[model samples]
Target: GMADETILLADDDPMIVDPLALQLRREGFTVHIAVDGEDALAQARRVTPDVVLLDIMMPKKQGWEVCRELRAESDVPIIMLTARGEEMDRILGLELGADDYLTKPFSARELIARIRAVLRRVAMDSARQASPAAETASDDDVVQLGRVTVDRARYQVAVDGEPVHLSQREYSLLMALLDAQGAAVKRGDL
Candidate 1:
């Protein structure tokens, strides 16, 4: 169903990369491999992939560096791959703007499920944005503050009829503040 999707798999191990590539291809995804984090960044810029499966420990540039750089330049979905015991690494990955995370030694089926779920969220958000009128609004869907308008259903914001680009966290924070409707939102409330 996702034949048009392209996934960038960045891992130093051929054993992991090769088998994962085959499985992903069989499931109708185009797979690209990067042996190092630096190569991963280069390939991501070149190919403009749909999603990235990044290994936390890689040569050249570490996955954290790659994820930070990618998040700065684009909002592409990133799923971090960490070793079994690296709970801190997984949390760090998310803080660095990863859309999801999967630990090492995971089954291909689980990985595929995560990818599909992420893609589906994106698709649904896109649909919501495209047809805002079709969805019911309970004052939380859209917010207007001065010239800026926030469309929470689609994760979009606009100012003076022009679209504005915001990262996921930025959008969430904006929505939260607007939800308060000019009331003081304590730091803990936010």
Candidate 2:
């Protein structure tokens, strides 16, 4: 639950940060604040936060730079926040490995929802990785969808018991979709 999660909020504006921090705290998250990009990186390394809410404009270092550095060091989920809603900025954030992005003037509820979604996605990914592909898998490893059966252990797939050819990328995409279990996977995530 949110009670156990720590959130690092990095933004220069107290007007945005103070109230937001209070709201998050009210929702039961342990909140950490950073006024600049450098401080953001510092707090992130120190606290090892469960998630990061990074604002795009800040002193010392920009959000994209911070996002790039953080992604290089850890798989911790990052949600980029910005007043700008340009498509290019959103694309750049995703390209830099941000887990999600939110434009400013957003409701606190939406922000919280995004945070939870990212957390859920990260947890699912971790669970998937915890089951090593190198280890032998029992019958439970097989996932069925419609006429397709995926043998995760064997890295093979069959349709109606007939082997189907799939590129590595295709197989990975298929696995990700199956992992969602009907959840809507955002395009940026894919």
Candidate 3:
């Protein structure tokens, strides 16, 4: 839930930051405010906010610089707020890896919705990485050891196109063996 999530909001205008911070806090987010690019990077590294609401025009460091720097190091979702509603500005922001773009004077509802949507996309991506893949995979997902083929996504092994059933312990041991890259692993460690 958003209650457990934090947001790093970077903007120079107190008028924008104060009211938005209040609104976000009221919606149950832990909001961290940064007045400029330097502060934004510091707070972002320290707080590791789940999302960032970055103003396109900030002092100390421009929003474009902050966005580029942040994208280079982390995939934390970013929503850019820009007073310049030009198509070129929007394109440039998206090209820099912003998850979404918000024009200035945008509706509060739309801002909140964008935040929620970006968060949801991030969660879904994490889930995909955690979930095991299926046997039907591209060439990248399968590994062959002589006649035996391992389907990493499905956690399945087969030889000559026939499945090899393995117990839970067996599967775990197999994974451990695979991870060792042929190096001997101590039984005690397992």
Candidate 4:
């Protein structure tokens, strides 16, 4: 599974880049190196690596910019690496759609673990989206709420073609309540 992954490591420091690249390659990943933000963007557009390890501070563009730009074009997973361990930087990176964050002076083993986790999540999400089970519903799908119809597959609720927006948790709770066969359902049952 690791053999199918191409990871882009974008850092300006050669000392940091060299060792990490070697370790990632040793783990059977195809590694691509970029020294700065601009080069990172270029390499991403070229190779479209499965995952990107981005340094916060780099020339031409910063990590935040690269993250935003990449997110606008593709839903590729990003993990921001920063030397600063400030809370604000971590919050800001997550707000910019980075899937994970790592501080510098981190161990190669830890970095590898983080990479595996992010990649696994991405793979699981893609699998869920592609699975036909997500498109079809069982015969027990509908929940009667006095006069409402809920279709879980299309994530839609309608009362005679009028749409209602319900969060996933809300929908699940409502369905559980409706399925109680006229008996009261406890709050913890949700």
Write one digit per residue (lDDT tens) for candidate 2, span 68-111.
99999999999999999999999999999999999998888999
Q: In lDDT terms, which candidate is top?
A: 2
How close is every model to the real structure, measured as TM-score? 0.72, 0.71, 0.70, 0.74
Clashing pairs in 3: 133-153
Better of 2 and 3 by TM-score: 2
- TM-score order, best first, reads 4, 1, 2, 3
Question: What digit string (tens of lDDT, one per residue) describes model 4 on residues 1-190?
Answer: 7787999999999999999999999999999999989999999999999999999999999989999999899888999999999999999999999999999889999999999999999877677558544322334455445468777657689887588888878877866765664567787887
Give the TM-score (vs. native) of candidate 3.
0.70
Q: Kindly provide the TM-score of model 1 when superposed on the true structure, using C-alpha atoms.
A: 0.72
How does residue 52 of candidate 4 score in lDDT? 98
- Native-to-model Cα distance after best TM-score fit, residue 50 in candidate 2, in Å: 0.3
Can you write out model 1's per-residue Cα lDDT over 92-123, one digit (the tens) per residue? 88999999999888999999999999999777
lDDT (CA) per prediction: 0.87, 0.90, 0.86, 0.87
Q: How close is candidate 4 to the true structure, as a TM-score?
A: 0.74
Name the lDDT value of residue 86 in candidate 4: 93
Query: Which parts of model 2 have CA positions greater than 4 angstroms off?
Result: 133-190
Highest TM-score among the candidates is held by which one? 4
